[model samples]
Target: MATLSASPNPNPNPNPNFRSPTDQTDHDPESLPQMELHPSSDQDPTPNSNRNFHAVLPTPPEATAPAAAAAPSLLHISFNQDHGCFAAGIDHGFRIYNCDPFREIFRRDFDRGGGIGVVEMLFRCNILALVGGGPDPQYPPNKVMIWDDHQSRCIGELSFRSEVRSVRLRRDRIVVVLEQKIFVYNFADLKLLHQIETIANPKGLCAVSQGAGSLVLVCPGLQKGQVRVEHYASKRTKFIMAHDSRIVCFALSQDGQLLATASSKGTLVRIFNTVDGSLLQEVRRGADRAEIYSLAFSSNAQWLAVSSDKGTVHVFSLKINGGSPGIDRSQSASDPVTSPHSSLSFIKGVLPKYFSSEWSVAQFRLVEGSQYIVAFGHQKNTVVILGIDGSFYRCQFDPVNGGEMTQLEYHNFLKPEAAF
Candidate 1:
């Protein structure tokens, strides 16, 4: 990607003693207060020109090739564990945004133009895990920078031999994913607790339960199309054969009691009982093969949302009862929105499997071919969609009437002018 030119900074540092991360004096005595970002007319729209406080970090050797012409300006985007907020990694730094009302909370702009490839939040907290990426990186690609927003500096760092593919955070733990390895650390002390070797995971596919008192982690098993689940509380590990092809994408429920998985085939999505590795429910995305970008289960495990390369976001109503630990089955099923099925489904076992497959209850069409991830919003009957093209959408689906979801809000988060 071509570098966007940025004008000189107008809001110079007022504190003479302030220094960037590159300075010998990396620690600050006073903590920086969180300031609500208010983009002014004079501010440049490029992320590098944001008015946020700047940090000077060490520059790493650039071994990667130039970004492609069609590369996304926003390197990465992911919601917090609770879906109340989200983090966007950009070419310069990273920005945090509120998901419900859709507002920019704060952002960090590094003076050295360090592109943050990955940013993982600990549920709208001050601490965030940052991995250097893009054509030009801010830090070494193999290092994970643990940033503390309150202190406005890196609190700790984790170095690896290979580039970090992804990072996941919990209140008590931090999980880092590599090409074929994963490291789990105690968040408070950054002490290594466990490690696992997986079949080549270039996409860094991993999911963890966010519920307290339970630690459930899902990752690729040793065999293709298999999923390994770790039940830390019970000290048990279960492997489930999820599909015929390799596992492409999967998501764990908030409680970790239920799991949703999609294989490289991308047509069928299976829900599993994490405790016993039992098949709970299965739904069909489409008859044709497509790349499954994301899968998410509603907080109550009543509905699941799936996004694919085909440009359609599908929401399927779950009919299984979550009865085990970490599962929340309190939401009454009295009111339900059923997914449409083929008219031939009425004939039991008389036609091809395609005729009996379940379809989406609600659908949202996007620009085909653009990568996007979907998450169930905190708002009742709403789904949040984030596209690599910098598009953010919040759409609400009707429970009584299911088909097309109503668009509630849309924003271009990467375009600074529109972002504000």
Candidate 2:
């Protein structure tokens, strides 16, 4: 899933501790033609705001109380396209960290105490899409500032009439999502390529394929329970009525060939073939409804992982292939696909749907009610989870056994002292 930003709104008030900020280098005006769409500022405009440009490290446990008084507020968090790295936007600045051997690669603090609400990274490149947020924004909430870390400046920007809900990036394109519209631009020169209209998307729900040579974009459609798939390569648009309720969250495979969606009902997650919009598989998250926070496909698309308010991360095996009729029903004790099913499944049609629904093969439990996003790790059979409560977990699942996953690592990225 892309990084979600708060709805565009004016800053409440300026932080009194902020100090004057140093000016950033101006972009070459002769570089690109001025057009209707413009970007925002990276240089802090508040002359009295404090600026603390430094590499941030975890405060010692003994200093936790004091640090809490001045700790930077987390504004946003997201994984890169490949999930090899992740970024966190804070009120003071943003920090990027490696995923596998988790470590903060670098951090940029605007001592002026400006907040970054959204940070979209293109793989691990220096280029990033940033939007201002929090009580004291670093930039206007209506603009998407393209930041170039190598130069330590904003190289370009995309301005809109309203606040930007989120931004998606690819090697060749930049996608900006508003409440009801989406704009696609050519990355090389920031030329507007296409525009799309969507339903009231306050969460800025959008997903794009990261596979090279293919452009697949998915967003909410005009009607409830609808999803729009844009296949730029084939010049085709496919709309799928994914559910009867409102779409809460969805994810596309790396190749954009498969899509998984959960609705406000949230008990069921359906996977579809992007090419034909055909139902390929359906998995149950629970008998009762729950908010599905995130869904992800393994690099090979053989497994699907889901996280929800239930404080559980469930991994389900994907057995259906594109263009195939349905899931392969042949099963045995030795079968590799180990997703659990109720023993009452024998009378599926006679019993409630819950009795026959397929359940996760493996699960990891956490504190209930906190938001967490999950993604399959680069390491095989591993899943990486990031939580709003500052928890980071990496667990390995036994594909053949199907049960509780083994916790391999844990860290409180937000409160490192807690990890100690």
Candidate 3:
């Protein structure tokens, strides 16, 4: 079974940190103009092209107390897929934690900087991307400092014209999401590989496929309610007129074979083939409109998870065959579920659209609270939710029945000695 994860929300405008206000009204799905595509020439597949960028490292500032003085506010949190470790960004800096032992690996404090607004780790350890935070930041927000843990110094840096909303690192390339634009750089040399213009993506919504032989980048298209896909290895591109409403969420599978999307309407979620932009399946969140926090796909690409403003998470089943490496022609035939509106009865046809909107197979609900971040563990069939109040919960979902999720662990990282 596959498991997906995403950030959950509380209100119509649930996420105050990243989302720009958008008109959620549904509109006509007129065709969008396609953008020119370019293929990447390097066929090496892996981004381990250059190591010379690490030869000379800039000295780090003199160390003060890297750990928190007492209690530090949690600003942002992210998991390093390269390593099994998850990182919590605090007012002082960032803390790294190992999941297996549930212990703190090390703490990096902002000796001169104000705070760590956002921090992303590359793999297990060492390389990190840090953006300045605080009311009056010590460093320029437009500059991304590349920190090397081994030498405790800056090895390289990438500077942008505007503040970066988010950064995703792969062996071969660095994908940076800006407010309205995206920059793809050759990781080894920071060479400008591609530039993409998008909608007013204040949250910097962008996702990429890893280790999939082909480098694919998915983000908001030039038009609202559209999704743009770039195939780096083959230099091809496909545009999916995904929604008749503004897009609110996006999730890509590990291998870049599938893409999941949600619109501001929040009533339905659709899955598409990354290779050709074919509609694979469409799922529903609810009948009424709500804000969506996150969308994720399992490692195996068989399951999908969605969290929305209703403080509820729904898991949907994808008709993926267990045996075949790719699509199974018989998988859809073996399943009984079909499109929500695929009814034959006469009475059902006269009902409102809400009556035909899809429902989830399994769901987990939390008490109404602040904004929350949600995601599935990279290698485990676990759902991880992080709340604004610093509470963390990890639980497992029963694939057999799509029943109540079993709690595996919980922690409050904000309190002294409360976080593990």
- Model 1 C-alpha RMSD vs. true structure (Å) is 10.7
For each candidate in turn, the TM-score is 0.82, 0.82, 0.77
Task: Score each candidate by Cα lDDT.
Answer: 0.77, 0.77, 0.65
Tell me how far the alpha carbon of residue 245 in candidate 3 is from the true structure, in angstroms, after superposition: 2.0
Please provide, for model 2 over 34-150, each residue's C-alpha lDDT reduced to its tens digit, 9 standing for 90 to 100.
222222232212222213122222332244344334556788989988888888888867777778988766666764566899999867666678898888888878878776654
Please write out the lDDT profile of model 3 over residues 22-141, one tens digit for every residue: 212211112110111122344212222222222211222223424444677777777665335677777766667665445666665654445667777765535577776656443456
Which parts of model 3 are misplaced by more than 4 Å? Answer: 1-67, 320-348, 378-380
- Between prediction 1 and prediction 3, the one with superior TM-score is 1
- TM accuracy, model 2: 0.82
The sequence of per-residue lDDT tens digits that candidate 1 reaches over residues 1-420 is 101112232333222222332233422212221222222333232353323323653332121212212233688899988887888888877778888888777666665567899999876556678888898777777777777654556545666778899999887787999988888876655556788989999999999998755789999998999999999999999999999999999999888888999999999999999999999888999999999999998888888999999999999988786445545555445556566788889884988888998888889999889999989898899999999888899999876578899999998876654434
- On the 0 to 100 scale, the lDDT of residue 342 in model 2 is 89
At residue 397, candidate 3 shows an lDDT of: 76
TM-score between model 3 and native: 0.77
Number of the candidate with higher TM-score, 1 or 2: 1
